[model samples]
Target chain A: MARSQSQTVSLADVADAAGVSAQTVSRVVRGSDSVRPETRDKVRAAMDDLGYRPSFAGRSLKAGRYSSIGLVMLNITDTGNMLRLEGITSAAAAEDHAITLMEMAPGETLSLTEASRRMSALPVDGMIFNLNRMVPDFREFKPLPGLDTVIITMLEHPTCSTVDNDQMGCSEMIVSHLLEHGHANVHFISGPELSISGAQREEGYYEALASRGIPAPEVLRGDWTADSGYEAGARLAADPTCTAIYASNDAMAYGVAVAMHDAGKRIPEDVSLVGVDDSLGLFVPHNGLTTVRFDNRQVGLWAFRKVTGTHDMPRGRQHVLIPGTLVKRGTVAAPPSR
Target chain B: MARSQSQTVSLADVADAAGVSAQTVSRVVRGSDSVRPETRDKVRAAMDDLGYRPSFAGRSLKAGRYSSIGLVMLNITDTGNMLRLEGITSAAAAEDHAITLMEMAPGETLSLTEASRRMSALPVDGMIFNLNRMVPDFREFKPLPGLDTVIITMLEHPTCSTVDNDQMGCSEMIVSHLLEHGHANVHFISGPELSISGAQREEGYYEALASRGIPAPEVLRGDWTADSGYEAGARLAADPTCTAIYASNDAMAYGVAVAMHDAGKRIPEDVSLVGVDDSLGLFVPHNGLTTVRFDNRQVGLWAFRKVTGTHDMPRGRQHVLIPGTLVKRGTVAAPPSR
Candidate 1:
């Protein structure tokens, strides 16, 4: 099948067919509102007759702007990633700009050379990198000479702007809340050690305990999956002193809850659970599992704004950290008497 | 900031600077591996010195093909939508094609005219419309002259190819399972009335009941939310005769589970519950809510293939329906004796 018969058709050909100037044909092709309805109809009919198709590439070459943003994400399947994309898309739509999305293969780390290659090929005015994996050092990560770039990561870059949630603060808040509830100590279920956010949260957990003169206990590691959380919870459930548990994410916390239930330990009455990310609120509803909520969408929005130079803040490598709110629910309670 | 200094650099200029022919410059720009290492370095240095950046748009115009696909989604926030996007992106990346994403504003429907406009402006050879709402008449929905298009919906368009899960079959399987479990009649918590998938599922529910010579009971409406399912579950809980419930989606099914718990009804004992879309499996592991699972990712991958004309099928409008599998977890059981 013929994909496009208009490959050879030019603006001059359309203009000649429509009995108009090339500029008039160009205006019609660009969907300019200034063209008269009758004139536009005549030009469209001429285009159809000549098999002329307008191309966004031609328009971009002429206007020097693509009116679109490129988004580099590790994956869109994660709940946090989806919410961030929603925010970015909403902002782009409001600005009348389109979004070009690119996802890295699972377990793929984006290198500086690959990033530069993608930026050069992408027909976008700016790009937002939402990859959670470790990024190339900002000093060495030079984007295409002219493309504006922003990264969503826990670490601040010296050149590229950054946006992230306050991961450390979220953990500190969870630990303090558990401590304030009079628990002797809060056992931790940490996320993967390689994750930047996970490392920050773990640091905060230790810092919060240190500030209160409580020695840190052993940390159970989880790969941010519910099953991993379940395994960790089983170990915690076997220890009577583990009355309070903190999982790095909501999925893991739900797993811990299930493990506790299977062990015949009632929530709050026997054990208190808290997690980061209030993602399970939709499924669990009124059964509150105390957790920290981050507006990842806001992070996305700010990243877009920074990349596009649309934000009110001073330009040049700005770092914006969105704070997480601690949601108190039914999970935390005073420790049971020994 | 100056966006692109290479706007004025031409291929001829780069060739002159590199002391090579225009063809050689073009070959280097395309990242062809045929050039000698020393020659490639010379060309690269020339390109950098002349501020010559390779543009995908320029390459597309020259090759008469855009190595990109346009994905039009209603929203990416939904769990199903995100999964479909993951599948599409994975397929696209594997094929070395970029994805340009466009999202419709909430409450906004895509009219044929609007669709035609988007198709014209998009620099993509093909487009996949992942909108769940009602579409225009297939006869009137003409895409830009030769641009390939695919729609993901319950209904089929004579002109545009389509890929969808068997929504009706999913519901039928749910009803059949409940009936086989010895329930008198199944009560349905349906999705929004205007949703195409919702309508098809509801029809299947009725058809399955009719086939079994069982009259359809009162239908409880839900907007595909857990809260709406909770409301419906409360009404069903008040009537002890209503022992079996089928929620159109898993979110509502989870809500129903919560309501049953509140009412002190043991799952599969006091009430047998089934839901479509095993989405809650991530959060509520092992506590089986017997649900139907559709491979939405497969639907998305097939839709991408159809739109790009890459699938090994006939070169006309074709419909592909992915089947759903009934996963009997822990929620279904024999109805109690009246």
Candidate 2:
């Protein structure tokens, strides 16, 4: 959706809402010392309510340089985000651009209005809003917020500038590899339902089945953890129809492998399997898992460049899709039925 | 090494060497504007040569409230560092502090003098330096460099306020648990020798063995990856003299499990095992990983709190040691011979 020319709110409107002087809000926006914490918080809340957007001219005149970039995420508990940030920040550092990482809870946060106010106050150049699960439809960190933003995620929201590994593509490649190896009707074990990546990957699994003219069997659900994978695998192993299985990530794949072994199914001979993220985990020869591999670090590198506009950005919303390839090891092969 | 009063380098000397004005050098140290990139570089290089220490007066006068906390990681690629930072940054967000993460290569960076110059120039209110490996013995981020700093690492030097997990105590608890269960001649797998956490855990291992009057068996080393664990396990399994195994991390523990399985030895039933850091790897089961479970997240929380001096920093040099308990699982038990 295009920005509404008429609906763009001003800093004065936010100043009016907060019952504070416009100068105080301006000081907060420019990161000046003249404002108090209580005043800043109040202005932030008001800006969010008013959908107040900072114009580049106004921001630049007050703050010397809007050269810093923001890398926003919902959760920091996952190593994936940290690793991705490593790649991005290192790249940013190499270019002498300071990165400001902002951790925000999507949807669960105190309304989009309030969130926008706080986000607008930060003096930054551009941003990378990473949505591990949920995210907004556009780069509106809050309404009418004007800044060049790139979203780093698996979600295929075509309207935004994003740089991430192709989760949907990885899913297709995973299933096709198994099907090509003579496995029929592949079993699917997925990550948490709330994840946008998980949903897209699931969709890819079904689409691949349809493309191959093979009927999709019942899919086992998982929470993207090894524990959840084990639970799902236990159920899959009990059924005779299950010949091959695919877990969304390597952790879950490990769980499924153990469950299959416990159930007395010889890998590939009885049940072929595949996983995502050819993690450092699969180097264990006993559980040498065959899966898809992609460099998330490279995704991070591209993300930094795109967000910073270090060079010319690719045209048309700019979704830089990194591909994941099937890494054939001991896990995938023809089913016994073949 | 103590600073010699007469031998101490002056700011004027540094300025002369860098071919910059004294005021220009001072501006760079305080991170003020009006300094050119080329001039800043020159000043930094000159300061590095003279071992110049920046002044604190200007910095102290400027910093009122901590807007950002600096996090200096030994290596960004280390997954433990990643997880620890995630905890630290998340906790920091709640406290209304922005994170400035610096991926520094202390050894490879410009001379320590220049390194000092670069760091002194960075204007962070407080900092968390996670020294995983053997780093410069500066004792501080150049020893206070004019701000509140907490070294959240396995630093042995008696300098800045240190806050680290009680790994030494945790290891003993784990070893005692294994020994009490009747395992004798326990084999140990360690992480990189450079890590203080690894060294502390090793110290605990040796102490437990020494007190119990058991001969110290040969040590196998790992880089804390699952693959290294497999290699270490293979070496141990090849030696029929070895029985119970303890790895530095869960990933390596899982590696050892795989190696033992391949070596025709059963887990617990044949070669009992234990690990530290409870990092639920792809192969390590929750109950099967009879390892020390410590709240590694607290290290970050404490570091963040201390750096911000949030609520008076509690008191003392504050060497916090979190207790680690064994999650009695299937991995550890008595040796078959016992």
Candidate 3:
């Protein structure tokens, strides 16, 4: 590759232009609190004038660290995963780190050996796994002996940092809200069978029902897709006893909403609906589906911090839980009188 | 920084295990088409058994190409951008390439000087810019002097390859559909004021109206968001004469749909609606809004090929336009009785 070598400016050049020492320039670039505002401004001005871009390549070489992170993600056409990617990217940029992405197709698992091989090949200081399904044996894949690794999952790997939303709490909130809306029976629409989050959410649903002394209803399984939700909705819509339903995610909620519409049933009128993740608001502002808002961005951000050793967390394998908030939209209402 | 060397397996081990020469093992690892299937299978089996991973660091040293590409994208919370990223990632993986992402904050521009500096620093052999808005003077930034570069946009720049969906053609097909559905004037809900796609869409809207001898309605501006769409939809709902609306993208269209629903105006019954991009189907499954579908994945794939120098083209500032298809659903209809 014939790269342009014309605009390369060193820290010394910026320091010379700003009438400061190279150490002072480095301190300013590093955003040290000790640097006076006047000196910082001067350094910035000099950088702007000379178009000095701090090269991570040179810095990493000196520091003996790659200053790069690897994100291993499952291949899915989910907007949620993308949002997380955006979060990780932005956070990495803020910390002056780069990302090397390794994506695998759905159902294709990166074996322990494969991950180990990739870790040695990639010149990254840390790794984050943005997987849809929780890997039970993730702890076994110790790619680098002391490499900081973070996993975005519900299950807590005993030897790896975990960043995840409080799935059980989110599920409880949705179910509790539906019960408060005067719905006698709140049927549950769960995610995939083996999904750790799905299992946690179902447990939360049971806990909500158990606390209220209401018997747990049968759970409907969905693959976290609108089509699956639609299929479940069709089945539930046909059952007259099914009034309020709580879906695992917003995509499935949209599917349920569609199936109800196709069945000539009005939302919140015939069957009140609630879903986890307010992403529905982004995609279907018109649906007004009541949902729980969990920021996947926060999950991504925390994962980045864990891998980069920035967060003031415990040294051992840690689990960071992001709380979910209830976003009351138009979808939930008091159940219709029989 | 402590890396484990215990699990490292050399190529000689795999060659010895497979009863093949080290050169034959290398050819199989490189995915050379010349290697016999039976020999390739034997080497692959040996690799799987021994857990031998080929290090790109060593391979690239001999190949003289870093099998990595940089994707510079605008930082925004758009699902469409994520979808395009997924496309690019999957395509890159197929070709055994890694992606280094460089995301600038929303409303922040990657200046010519900054891009040039980053290009020289990044270890990528090529780069792809996945930008939302058309850069007015994109030609000014020539980052890599001789490295392959691809831009996903409608605007043509000399000395760079451009891959994009035909914005005007997509808009025209949508507008013509509304006009054919008996809409006297097709009102356009335009994107941001400075958007290149917005400008192109608005032009296509005007062209459709002009061809039918009907004056184009005043354009309603949006920031490519649902809230902006909702505001425009609210304003249009107040006007009894406004029958058909063409939103530049699906998010805005969703916002418009919500506003119409809130105002008790039935979609396609009181006012017809059409939007670009079938992403509306994901969020507003029940609304069933008519839209145009453009394969952004194809754009990502082609961009990757252009950067890797795999595409067979006559070089020099190529413009590859992806075609769009009209997806007619429930939202579009003839204008209400006068």
Candidate 4:
């Protein structure tokens, strides 16, 4: 009754008012079934009288579980990243857990020690690393002492679970499709160097061409943006011999399409184009962009499950790669006669 | 040294091992400068020996500050929502705070009581409601007892700070621009009925038309997706008198464009088209879409600041509206002579 307006009422205050022990008050707060109905009612009334608000931190500290998952993303602006987030969030919600989103500053790369330190300070039971950047060495990257971690990367860690789309296979499928269309040589618009998926995709591009006895053209690097794709496309458009192109992602492919249009080149008629991630469908109605369709949301969902230890792989660390399907739209065609 | 692998090492164990008080060990774990260097080092060494990991929950319980901000979004898949998320995350990173993201399941509506209950249970100091749903009555929608709240909605509450784009102004700007293009009538594609921004934009459309002494056409309803826009566009395309069209958002406009193209009507030749949110720039290159451009990121940044009580308006609750600029592309032109 003598409490100041700014002062926070604690469990002790409610206990004192209810004539109950602090443990009993805590049990009531946690909604434990052990407490008698009368005692629970008394504590609830006292809590209302004291205007006591329960603290999740206090509850978590006692239970040793935060009921929250830490999501470390490199960036959220990317469509792929957003889709993954949607999947992760949906999974988390289904499991009655909250997602703590932590994004690295635009170009910040975290060392293992730094990542460990940061993750240890979070009030979360587990962490999901949705950062697209490649981990240089899994041997050097040890998991945090007490935190469960799931990395969304191409590289598999000895002690951590990994979730990723079949980056290499996606590129291989695209390249094979282009080759089937009778293109003599296919140029690739690669993603950023720091990206593990990008590197794997480029490797697949090389393997596909090498297998077919066709030498791959020099890669045009794009930063997974429409602008970057446009610049790469402009250079490719000038080369009359460059008949087919596989952009690493859809946004860049869209940029390439625009660049081709500007240079008076028709899609498929003059040069064929294909991209990964069938995301352009949402933005462009009847876009006819031939792309590799993989569920990024499934990757997020799997990553969340792995982090929470709710996944089927209970014994050993597993690397789950969701496969991509090549969706043939109007972009691919046989190379034009010289 | 005798501890089992399953047993957690508490502050008491560290204190006993270091021959110090539990409070001293706690101070060391919290990195408090109040502890002596030698004692701190001893406690830390004991913690290392016992494999003790500092619990953020314990720290938050003692400090009564979670150092987190809860972000409640209606959905995360929308382009507008994604942009806002980018802004909020960037701002949170700058402020050294993590974001707890909680999204309502698709088509799920939250009553004020339910919203308050959820907010009260989160381990966060404040909350940012990025839910775009309209609050039927602000009087009935009370802020959670002890949490700081900032809502992203058109309606303002007495106790809560609000952040929004100039929704009404955006529609007015679009309508006036279409009128200036010498169009007798401009048809509108409205967003979902539950959307606060959508309702305001509809009001602005009516106001703009009424002031100009031009009768407005029947509103075509859309759910903010490209697919829905296509459905609405098909209906408008069949009507010969529907010369000018304005979509509430860009995705719908893109759908409308595709529909018009399918109907063998050239954009700005047979029917002029315009949209809100210049989001198509990132997806489509050479897409001459006349639109209103507003920074959803700014709305996010402002909302974070408001929730944190770090905004410019310190004395009273305020509604912060980020203005939209009318961006002219090639979508609008004089109507074709009948």
Query: Where does candidate 1 chain B have its weakest 10-residue lDDT segment?
Result: B1-10
Instruction: Give per-model CA RMSD.
Output: 3.7, 17.8, 6.8, 3.8
Clashes of each: 0, 3, 0, 0
Per-residue alpha-carbon lDDT of candidate 4 for residues B78-128, written as tens digits (9 for 90 to 100): 778898998998999888898998877765566554666676787888888
DockQ-based CAPRI category assigned to the predicted complex of candidate 4: acceptable
Using DockQ, give the best candidate's number: 4
Taken over the whole model, the C-alpha lDDT of each candidate is 0.83, 0.71, 0.79, 0.83
Q: What order do you get sorting by DockQ, best first?
A: 4, 1, 3, 2
lDDT of 3 by residue, B268-314 (tens): 89888888878744544354778888888788888888778764756
**Segments of candidate 2 deviating more than 4 angstroms:** A1-63, A105-116, A136-146, A156-159, A283-287, B1-66, B105-107, B110-123, B238-240, B281-287, B314-317
lDDT for each residue of candidate 1 in A4-30, tens digit (9 for 90 to 100):
563557799889988999999988877
As a TM-score, model 3 comes out at 0.79
Q: lDDT by residue for model 3 over A1-338, one digit each (tens)?
A: 22234545789988998999999999998889999999999898987777676654456545556678888887546666777787898899888888888786665665643654565466577788876765545767654554578888887776778888898888788888888888997988999997777889899999989988999878899988898999999999999899999999888988998788888898878899988877754533354779888888888888888889875856778888888899888888899997
How many Å off is the CA of A16 in candidate 4? 4.6
- Chain A TM-scores, per candidate, are 0.88, 0.75, 0.78, 0.85
Model 4 local distance difference test score: 0.83
Colliding pairs, model 2:
A48-A113, B48-B113, B48-B114
Model 1 per-residue lDDT tens digits across residues B151-209: 88878777788889999889889998888888989999999988888999999999999
